[model samples]
Target: MRAIVVTEHGGPEVLHPSEVPAPEPGAGQLAVEVAAAGVNYIDTYHRTGRYPTKPPFTPGVEVAGTVVAVGPGVTGFAAGDLVATADAVGGYAERALVNADRAIAVPAGADLRLAAAALLQGMTAHYLTHSTHPVLPGETVLVHAAAGGMGLLLTQLVKLRGGRVIGTVSTPEKERLAREAGADEVLGYDGFAEAVRDLTGGEGVAAVYDGVGRTTFDGSLAALRRRGVLALYGAASGPVDPVDPMRLAGAGGVYLTRPSLAHYTVTREELAERAGDVLRWVASGELKLHIGRTYPLADARTAHEDLEGRRTTGKLLLIP
Candidate 1:
C-alpha cells in the first residue's frame, strides 16, 4: 500500500507517498478500502507545524469508500457498505481503520468523490449553520472564504434557512461561485469589511462566519450588529493575533466563538446526526458539493500546495 507520510512537519514538500503495509481494523473499527480522501486546511496546519502531530503519521482526516473488513463487536455494518468517515487518522492511503461509530453510510446515489468531499467541511458547515448561532430566517450572514468548499455548502444551507448571505472571496470567479451558491452579495476579500458594511446598508450583519482567520477576524467582528455571532472556524490567511476579550465587546457588543467540528459533534450520536443531515441534503440536491480539485494518492503534496496557496476552490480530495 502507498500512503502519505509526514515524518517531520515543515511544508507541503514534507508530504510524500511511501510504500507501507495495509492496516487492519481494531475492535469497533472498520478497515475501509480507501476510494477517496478529503483534504482540509487542518492538514496544512498539521504539516506546517501550526498544529503539531507526532512523527510518522498519515495526513488525511476523512475517507469515503467500501468497507472491506469489520472489527470485533462492530454492528449494523458489514463488508461492501459504502460509507464516509471523519476524524480518524491514516486515510491518505489505500486503506484506513476507522472507528465504526464515526462512519456514516453514504447515500446510494451520491457520487463517491462528492460524498468524500462532503464529510469534513460539509459537516463543519452543517454545525456552523445549525448549531453555532443557528442562522435564522431574514437574518443577515457574512461568510468568509465563501467560494471555498465549506463556504459554498454553508452559504446554500444558510439560504435554505432563509438567511441572507454575504460572502467574501478573492476574485471575480470566486464571487460568481459564491453568488451561485446563494450568497446574496459577494465581496472581494480585499477591503471586505467596507464591502460588507455597504452591502448591509451600514447596519452590519446578524452573524459573521470567519474562516479566513487573521486577515479578516477584526474586520468580520466590525461588520456585525450588536449581539451578532462571530464564529471563527479556520485561519487560512494566518492565525489570529492574540485578541483581547474586550475586542468582542468593543465591536458591536458581539459574541465570539472558535468552533471546530470535533467539538460540536462530540459523541457518536452527534456525529451521525450531523453527518446524516449533510448526506440527506446532498442526496436531495438541497446542498451541493463544489469539488474543486482532486489529486492521485501520490500527489498529495501538490494538493496541499494548491489548497494552501489559494489555487483552488471548494473541497480538494485525494483519489486513493
Candidate 2:
C-alpha cells in the first residue's frame, strides 16, 4: 500500500511517500479501502513531534472509504459499506484499519471525500458548540481563524444555535468567507479584541472559540465577558504558554479550557451523535464544507507545508 511516513520528527520535508504493507482489520476493526484521508493540524503535530509521536508512523487519523473486511466481533457493518471515522489507524494509506464502533455510515450518495473532510473537524465543532459551552440563543462569541476549515464550521454551528459570531481572520478573502459562513462581523487579527469589545458595547462576548493559540490566547481572554468561556482547542499559530490560574480571576472570572476530540467522544454513543449530526447536515446541504484542495497521496508533504504556512482555507484531503 502507498502511504506517507514520518521518517523523522521535524518539518513537512520529513513526510515521505513510501510503499508499505496494507493494514488489515484486527479484532473489532474494519479494513477500509481508503478513498480519502483528512489533512489536519494534528497530523502536522505528529510529523513535528509536538504531539510526541515516534518516527516512521503514518500520519493521518481521519478517513472515509469502503469496507473491504470486517474483523471478529464487529457487527452492523460489512464489506462494501461506505464508512468514515476520526479514529482510522494509519489513514494516510491505500488501506487503513478503523474500529467498527468508531465508524459512521456515510449516507447513500454522500461524497466520500467530504465525509473524510467533515468527520474530525465537524465533530470537533459539534462538541464545542453543543457541549463545551453550549452556545445560548442571542449570545455572541468570537472565533479565531474564522475562514479556516474548523473556523467556518464553528461559525455556522454557532449561528445554527442562534448565536451571533464575531470572527477574526487574517485577510479580506478570509473575512468574506467567514461572513458567508454566518459570522455577523469579521475583523483582522490586529486589535481584534478591541473590535470585539466595541461590537458587544464593551461587555465582551459570551465565549471565544480559539483554535489559533499563542498569538491569540491573551486577546481571547480579553474578548470574553464576565464568567465567559474560552475554549482553546488547537494551536495552529503555536502552543500557548503556561498560565497562572489567578489570571482567570483578574479576567472577570473567565474560564479557560483546553479540549480534545478524544476526550469528547469517549463513548460510541457520543461519537455517533456528533458524527451523525454533522454528516446529516452535510448531506442535506444545511451545513456546507469548502474543500480547499485535494492532493494525491504522494503530495502529503506539500499539504503540510501549505497548512502550516496558513496559505489555504477550508478542508484539505489526500486522495488514495
Candidate 3:
C-alpha cells in the first residue's frame, strides 16, 4: 500500500509519499480500499503540529471506499460493501482501517468521491446550524468563509431551515457563490460585522458560524445579536489567542462555543443521523457539494499547499 507519511510536523513538504505495508482491520474495524480521501483543515493542523499528533503518522481522517476485509466483532458489513467514514485511521493511503461503528454505508449509485467529500464538512455544517445554535425560522446568521466548502453547505442548510444567511467572503466571485448558495447578504471580510449590523438594522444576527479563526473571531462576536451564539469551528488562518470570559459578557451577554465534528458525532447513533442526513440530501439533490479540486494520491503535498494558500474553493479530494 502507498501512503503519505508525516515524518515530522512542518510544511507540506513533510508529507512524504512512500510504499508501506497494507493495514489490517483490528477488532470492530474494516479494511477499506480507499477510493477518495477528503483533504481538510484539520489534516493541515496535524501536519503543522498545531494539533497534537505524533510523527510518522498518516495525515487523513475522512475517506470513502469499498470494504475489502472485516475484523472480528464487526457486523452488518462484508468484503464488498461500499462504506464511508470521517474517522478513518490513516485515510491518506490506498487502504485504510475504519471502525465499523464510524463507517456509514454509501447509498447505492452515490458517487464515492462525493460521499467522501460530504462526510466531514457536511456533518460539521449540519451540526453547526442544526445543533450548535439551531438556526430557527426568521432568524439571521453570519457565516465566515462563505465561499468555502463548509460555508456553502451551512448557507444552504440555514436557508432550508428558513433562516436568513449573512455570508462573508474574500472576493467578488466568492460573494456570488455565497449568494447562489442562498445567503441573503454577502459581504467581504472588511467591515463585515458592520455590514451585518447594518443589514440587520443594528440588531445583528442570531448567530455567527466562524470557520476562519483568529482574524475573524472578534468580528464574529460583534456580528451577533444580544445573547446570540458564536460557534468557532476552525482555525484556517491561525488559532485565536486565549479569550477572556468577560469579553462574551461585554458582547451583549453572547454565548461562545468551540465545537468539532468528533465531539458532535461521539456516538454511533449521532454519527449515523448526521451522516445519513447529509448523504440523503446530496443524493436527493437537496444539498449541493462543490468539489473544487481532485488530486492524485501522490500529489497530497500539492493539495495541502493549495488548501493552505486559499487558492481553491469547496472540498478537495485525493483520489487513491
Candidate 4:
C-alpha cells in the first residue's frame, strides 16, 4: 500500500509518498479503505514541525472510508459499512486503522467525498458555535480567517444562532466567500478592529473567534466589548506569546480561553453528539461545505504546499 510519510519535519517537500505495509485493525479499531482524508491546518502544523509531531509518521487526522475489516469486539459496524473518523492519524494513506469508538456513521445519502471533506472541519465548527462560546441571539461574533475551512462553517453557525458576524479575510475573493457563508461584514487585515467596532456602532462584539493567532490576537481582543469572550482556537500566524493576566484585565475585563477540538470532544458521547449535529446539518442542507482541493494520497506534499501557501480556500481533501 502507498501512503504519505513525513520522515522529517520541515517543509511541504518533506511529505514523501512511499510503499508501506498495509495497516490492519487491532482490537477496537477498524481497517478502513480510505476514500478521502481531510486536510486541516493542524496537519500543516504537524508537518512543518510547528506542533512537534514524532518523527516518521503520517500527518492526516481525519478520514472517511468503507470498513474493509473490523477488529475483535467491534459490533454494529460490519465490513463495507461507510464511516468517518476525526481522531485518528495516518489518514494520508490508501488504508488506515481507525478506533471504532471514535468513528461516526456517515449518512448513506451523503457523498463519501463530501462527508470526508466536511466531517472534521464541520464538527469543529459545530462545537465552537454550539458549545465553546455558544453564540446567542443578537450577539456579535468576530470570526478570524472567515474564508478558511472552519471559519466559513463557523460563520454560518453563528448566524444560525442569530449572531452578527464580523469576519476577516485576506483577499477580495475571500470577502465574497465569507459573506456567502453569512458574515454580516467582511474586512481585510488592515484596521479590521476599527471596522468591526464601526460595524457594531462602537459597542464592540460579544465574542471573537480567532484562529489566526499572533498577528490578530490583539486586534480580536480589542474588537470585543467588556466581559466578552475571546476563543483562541488556532495559531495560523504562529503561536502568541504568553499573555499576562493583567493584560486580560486591562483589555476589557474579558473572559479568554484557548480551545481545541480534541479537548472539547474527548468523550465518546460528546464526540457522537457533536458529530451527529454536523452530519444532520450536512444532510439537511442547512450547512454547506466547500471542498476546495483534492490531492491523491501520493501528492500529499502538493496539498500541504497549497494549504500553507493559503492558495486553497475552505476544506481540502486527500483522496486515496
RMSD of each: 1.2, 0.9, 0.8, 1.2
Tell me how many residue pairs clash in candidate 3: 0
Between candidates 2 and 4, name the one with more favorable lDDT. Answer: 2
Worst 10 residues of 3 by lDDT: 102-111
Off by over 4 Å in 4: none
Q: Candidate 4 — what's its lDDT?
A: 0.87
- For residues 1-320, could you state the per-residue lDDT of candidate 4 as single tens digits? 99989899888889889899998888899999988999888998988888889989988889998989999999878898999988775989999888999999876656888778777888878878888889889998999999999899999899888998989998999999999999998889999999988998898998898988999998988898989889998888889999899988887899889888888788999999988888888878899888887877878888887877778789888888
Query: Using Cα atoms with residue i matched to residue i, what is each candidate's TM-score against the true structure?
Result: 0.97, 0.98, 0.99, 0.97
Task: Rate residue 107 of model 3 by lDDT.
Answer: 66
Per-residue lDDT of candidate 1, residues 1-320 (tens digit): 98999899888899988999999988999999988999998888888888878888898888999999999999989999998987766989999888888888875656889888887888898889999989889999999888999889889989999999988888889988998999898888778778778887888999888888888887888899888899999999899998898988888678988999899889989998988888888888999888888889999989988988988888898997
Whole-model lDDT for model 3 versus the true structure?
0.93
Error of 3 at 241 (Å): 0.7
**Each model's backbone clash number:** 1, 0, 0, 0
lDDT by residue (98-163, candidate 2, tens digit) is 999999999667789999999999999999999999999999999999999999999999999999
**In model 2, where is the ten-residue run with the lowest total lDDT?**
105-114
lDDT of candidate 3 over 152-269, digit per residue (tens) = 9999999999999988888888888888888888888899889899999999999999988999999998888999999999999999999999999999999999999988998899
What is the alpha-carbon lDDT of model 2 when measured against the actual structure? 0.93
Off by over 4 Å in 2: none
